[model samples]
Target: MEPVKFNYEYSRKIRVGFIGCGAHAFRNVYPTFDYAPVDLVAVCDLNQERADIYKKRFGAEKAYTDYKEMLKREDLDAVFVVLNFDRNGHPLYPKIVPDILKAGIPAWIEKPVAYTAKEAEDLVELEEKTGQFVLVSNKRYFYPSFEKAKLILESDPFGKPVSVSGRYPLTLSPFQEELGKRTNLHWFLDICHPMSGIHYLMGEVKEMCFIEHQPSGNVQTLLSFKSGAVGNLELPSTQADTSPFERYEIIGNKQNVLIDNGMRLSYYKGSKGSGEYGKAPSYIGDDPTDGPVHWEPEFSLGQIYNKNLFLQGMVQSVNHFSNAVLNGRKIERATLKDSLHLTKIFEAYKNNRSGKWITIE
Candidate 1:
């Protein structure tokens, strides 16, 4: 297959400013500008020295120690906020996003939008008032495999989705108070990683029942979607050290899909013919395409597919955001409304007790 083409000159280059100069942005975010329609004009961080270093490294023209000052001086079309969490592990996006919106600039914030549901909702309300866009960087939904899964679910080939199973190694505390205290911190920080894919594959969840295993600090959640599809989430924190971090499977009427370790993908459309007891001449003779469509990048070549943008879903996500801002198009995924739903899910896991079902609708 040919590499997907992205037109870097799609629109008049957007004058972009960055708010965080942390390691993640340095490694994953700023490098994406190479393929996107962005003119990085300025960057700001609390540390002037680090900001200056990024400005020089990423070819930005200006750098500042304060975001407010940078916003006032720079003529920016958009800003990317990759700031770290507070002492409580609560993401600082809610506090910074309002200021960016008030400054009349669209913003793309890193995941786990805020520490609490209320904080997330506040940002939603602010977007409505300011008429500016604020998107969370939920990269899993931007992945090619998950993107294909979404299209398959919507297409008639899969009929209708019946159920889904997601596996992620995340630690959950059984104690209610401990969970609440950790709500805005470690728990919410990672929930967006899996929940983003869930909301994208299946629409808004209507109700959910979860059971927590105390001994191993694992959680099993059963979710019923508004589309009458049921799903399960397995958050096992006790997996082997060498195992991958995540896995997912979605079952439909006649077809099923699985994404393993965020890279390998398989689609099972059922067997073509029944096999004999012992005289099956060729097991591969059933069907050519229906067998299993597997996908994983070959790292032999120095290609963009091997880069973090393609692997971490950063390129497509940033491209999508840029296109929406440039063309006045509505975003299909990672909108504020989607973030709101995800925030509620994180809160439910934090506040609700095991075996107590919660309604998110």
Candidate 2:
């Protein structure tokens, strides 16, 4: 991939439209334009007051309560959508996205991409029919630390990536199936983080097994990958809110890398030689290549890497979709395809109980 270019450095900027003037877009998405190659032409939301506020705050020229009207009136290269749950606990994007594509504009939508794999498949089919693609902005997969982890896993020093593991704070009750997808919405949506990360890092999952804790509703899943790699996913709803919410590790042949809370990264190159654990004079390696190389953000500085927009991957995801639209290339990150895979993982959890190995075909 090419080094990223700042907004000012782009010779021509894409004229873009935005939907959803919610807390998430306000805090994360809208602020990313300072680093992305786009000129916001309009903002749209169901609430005209909120839409007008976003338009003024973000320097967009116009605002509208109806996105359909916005799409019809504005000549846009692409649209960025950030709406979350609907009244029924459904995601609004799937309902609105086909309309956007029907209008001939490409889109970048936030996850959860759809309520199930079937819905995602429908969206993909519409995307192909309209000749317009949608990028889901899965967020976690675009994190700088996690992006580098993918690179490391694909390289030689690690031999081959054999397994991956991730942890998140989420509650999924077995009775969610009884309540169906809408009432158990958060469980279906939040699983996107771990599922997207694993799919992006290790390729497709072939099959998986799960077990849940009765008290906390925490669940652990074991995944076998099509690539011959395996993975573990932990959903610990009782985990402390004071600490970081997510962590990950991938074990390569004789090496492994760990990521904590999307910031700290550690690459453990196994001990230089398999000597007795207690007999070594010093743990320091004789060669720098024998590495447990590490990385983490330094908040004291004003670096871009330290900002939440960068650290959480909002800016990077925006820039990526913008570049794809501007360059006439298909967007790969968080594509409808990735969303489909993630929805399958969601379905597996909803459909199966402890000890069942559900194959993802």
Candidate 3:
């Protein structure tokens, strides 16, 4: 791994303006600037007090009650938006990002970029027209475990991933009336975390079928990937909050990889039986090198990896956008195009009932 540079160590930094002085921004996004190449020049929010507080707290040069005024006055290379849902429970990104694009400033916005795929399509069109890109902050794609998993999947040993299983504690309202309204989809929109990781690891879903449980409202979604792999997504809504909430496994040819609780990963490369199946002396295999490879964070050390900012991928995603803006690199992760795919999944769940195979295209 390359050594990480602190913000001051960079030879240059992008002039960044921030919109939305919310709690998530304060806790997750703003702290990332300490490690990213960002010079936070200005902040904006509808709440004047919050904006002023954020500017002072985060070391921004100026604060504004209106984001448009900030864009108008500040010479910014990129902007970070971390807005919350409006009263209607709809994300504010699709409504706001077009104006930022028109201003010729790249944007890094928090996800569920839009309530529908159509809104995402509009953003894609606007990005093409304005020549400014938007990177949705879907941090699941940047998670350290998933990053390592990608390398393992691409290696020669783990040949042809054939199936996937994922679990996340997210509840979906089964009623068609509730699904139709974005206001009612707050939980579904904000809490659908596993889909992004699944997309990153397994590629796009060609078709999907889901079955809902009655009292619990839990769901199990079956996916057929365009790559010819199959998948099962388990959204066990009634799972206890205190319990380990998420787990994932990708099965390849005679080899399988598992991610537990989004942090621990185990790769079970094809293991040979101890001697023969009937009369084995021990369960342990003969070759030490053939044992399953395992990885988990060491909490004792005061290292960057242990920090939630790095662990949960907030800093990595921020650095990715900042570097892309600074170097004019084409962003491969969490692009608007990726957002379109995720939005299609959202639309599929909302529009169709359980047990039906919905085609995604």
On lDDT, the leading prediction is 3
Q: Which predicted model would earn the best TM-score?
A: 3
Q: Candidate 1 — which pairs collide?
A: none
| TM-score comparison, 1 vs 3, better candidate | 3
* Residue-level lDDT tens digits of model 3 in 1-361: 2236899899989999999999999899999999989999999999999899999999999999988988999999999999888898888898899989999999999998998899999999999999889899898889999999988887888998899999988777755555453236777885437889999899999999999886677899999999999999999989888989899999998889898999999999746557766888766568767879899999998899999999899899998899989998767799999889999998888777788899999
lDDT scores in order: 0.82, 0.85, 0.88
lDDT preference between candidates 1 and 2, better one: 2
Summarize candidate 1's per-residue lDDT along 300-361 as a digit string, tens digits: 99888788688878888888887677777556678888888988888787777777879995
lDDT of 2 at 213: 87
**Which pairs clash (backbone N, Cα, C closer than 3 Å) in model 2?**
none
Candidate 2 lDDT, tens digit per residue, 1-361?
3346677887878999999999988988998998888999999988888888999999999999888888888999999999978776777777899999999999999889887688899999999999999999898778998899988988888877889989988887664555553245465577888788878888999999988887578888899999999889988899888989798899988889898987898989856543577776666666757768899888898788888888888888988888888899998788998889888888877766678789997
Count backbone overlaps in model 1: 0
Model 2, residue 87: C-alpha shift (Å): 1.8
Weakest ten-residue segment in model 2 by summed lDDT: 176-185
Q: Relative to the unseen true structure, what is the C-alpha lDDT of residue 328 in candidate 3, on a scale of 0 to 100?
A: 85
What ranges in model 1 sit over 4 Å off?
Answer: 1-11, 177-188, 275-285
Candidate 3 has a TM-score of 0.97
